[model samples]
Target: MQTRTHFTTRLAALVVAVAASALGCSAQADQTTDKIKSALVSRLGIDAGDIKGITKTPMAGLYEVNIGTQLLYSDANGDYVFNGDLIDAKNHRNLTQARMDELNKVDFASLPLANAVKVVKGNGSRKMVVFSDPNCPYCHQLESTLKSIDNVTVYTFLYPVLSPDSTAKAKQIWCSTDRAKAWESWMLDRKAPTAAGTCDTAAIDSNLALGQKMNVNGTPTVILADGTRLPGAVSGDRLEKALSSAH
Candidate 1:
């Protein structure tokens, strides 16, 4: 009888342990969800009524929040917020790149490719987008570096800065016989194109508006095919490394 009682006691304990474990998992899920909502409400200044849903990600404890049409993330406690490219270190892969790509997408098809001069190097299979000022020395250096790269098609936006003289030169380039040739002459040969002063050209106005929309506060900003932006003139090898790594 004593042995029977001991067995029953052990069985009861096992059942309690299993119940506690299940409850612990449920509680943790709730806590993380609660934290995510609370963090966004307090820090992001987003109205609680507008919050759609928050889903926990496969990336350990991180969460993916769907706020209307947008996606963002917060910590378990909703204490931290960031934009990050989740990578697979073991495979040297970009895991969250596709999601990030959707998040920061550009309408490549709709871009006024004609307003920007096109440079075709090699077979021009690879594509890149560059925003550059006519008078920016760093932009000139980037142009010089770009000439050496092969099999790449470049779309150059006329982002004039430095002074009023730069804008005038950009206008002249847009009105020149060959926009590509005009840009190269200014950047490579340090020769400014003569201003026919054509107000009809749309390149300067279009580029300026696009730059503002892209939050580009500086010159020589380069965007990769995967929608990832390099804020400055990146090195040739490093640029290739970044561009090729996109999934």
Candidate 2:
């Protein structure tokens, strides 16, 4: 009979052996990464620097590749590549998307709350961060939905990605004496903010860089307390569900 400890040790040995055989050498990780990068560049015509990451998956010989916000898969030697979701048939799970979401998520507390327009409702015990563009129609739609939710503290990052007008509008809103009110007025009441123009608006630039790092290319990207990112303007019911699930 195979004891539990023996089984664990044997499994580890098997994994190591498989990796060694697939990679052809147990060289440094840097070397391995370079080899994979070279293979990807040569075979797939992907720029080596554009490939954000390459890592081994749980399944032997399979590697995960990251290009910007998109995910790809390759064999050990990059001989074959796949650009799609990897589903677990037995567990009925979309592993590829799950991994992508996990990688893209950020610590909610780490966000620069001082830079955001803050709004509190009810007790305001629950917390959420929103990356919004002042010029985005979807952000206006989300603002309408958010008005109905309660007991939450909303931190709105003025992420201006849509147009030059969006950045100008974001700076205008940020420069207002009452940022939250200004944002609400603009997004909900269809009123534009009159720019004070003198307030230091460095936070907007920081938010833009942060959004890029987090792979947030779209407006109205909501981040729940548990680091789950919901892209686009989800419905109020779905938003409630996500909040409850995260809680």
Candidate 3:
């Protein structure tokens, strides 16, 4: 009985030692994170609000910094920062882009579809969302590419950030009797919208704010049904593959 009691006591002490070591390691990690964050703000002139998170990467002494949807890497001291793709050569994977894709994902169900110009092609079975600026040439190019895509419902949020003329055109498109048709006509044929920009166009302003909040820094930002964010104009084949994989 005495031997058993002694073994139990030693086991308890061992468990306590292990737990204390874990706590110490956790405190050290927290301190490292705080030091890195402070250094980034002071030395790099990065906004504290924009620093969403800082985590240690698999590489020794390397840390990953997440700012909005952008991914950056820094040393433990934060003295060195680099912006580029981190590739796992052996596995043939892009770690940085994979993380960005995860960080940029938006919940499809949370989108305000009513505020967007809805375009239905074919049976309109698949769904996607796009943030587009009227005057952005890339957006116009994407619109032409979208013509070949069938069986997809696209929700376009008029994000007028290029110029005042873009805002005016977006207002006219939103005020038009048939928003989808007006958007296609103007985008496809270079025809200006004829509707007076006098209707309730609060949705346009709302879309602008929403785009900013979502970190949509460019035109023709596409979001698939599964919350995959495509930052620029993608080919119809790529869109079809993404749509198929999403379903």
Rank ordering of all candidates by TM-score, starting from the highest: 3, 2, 1
- Per-residue CA lDDT of model 3 for 67-146, tens digit only, reads 98688899888899999998889999999988888889899999999999999999999999999999999999899999
Candidate 2 regions exceeding 4 Å error are 1-33
State the RMSD for candidate 2: 5.6
Model 2 C-alpha lDDT versus the unseen true structure: 0.88
Candidate 2 collision pairs? none
Better of 1 and 2 by lDDT: 2
- Residue-level lDDT of model 2, residues 1-247, one tens digit each, is 9999999999999999998877765465557667777898998789887898888777787788888789898877777889999888899999898898988877988888998999998898788999999989999999999999999899999999889988889999999988889999999998999976568999999999998888898989999999999999899999988887887
Best-performing candidate as measured by lDDT: 3
**Error in Å for residue 19 of model 2:** 15
Model 3: how far residue 247 lies from native, Å: 2.3
Candidate 2 vs 3: which has more TM-score: 3
Angstrom error of the Cα, residue 46, model 2: value is: 2.7
Q: What is the TM-score of each candidate against the true structure?
A: 0.60, 0.84, 0.91
Whole-model lDDT for model 3 versus the true structure? 0.93
Model with the higher lDDT, candidate 1 or 3: 3
Model 1 off-target regions past 4 Å?
1-102, 242-247
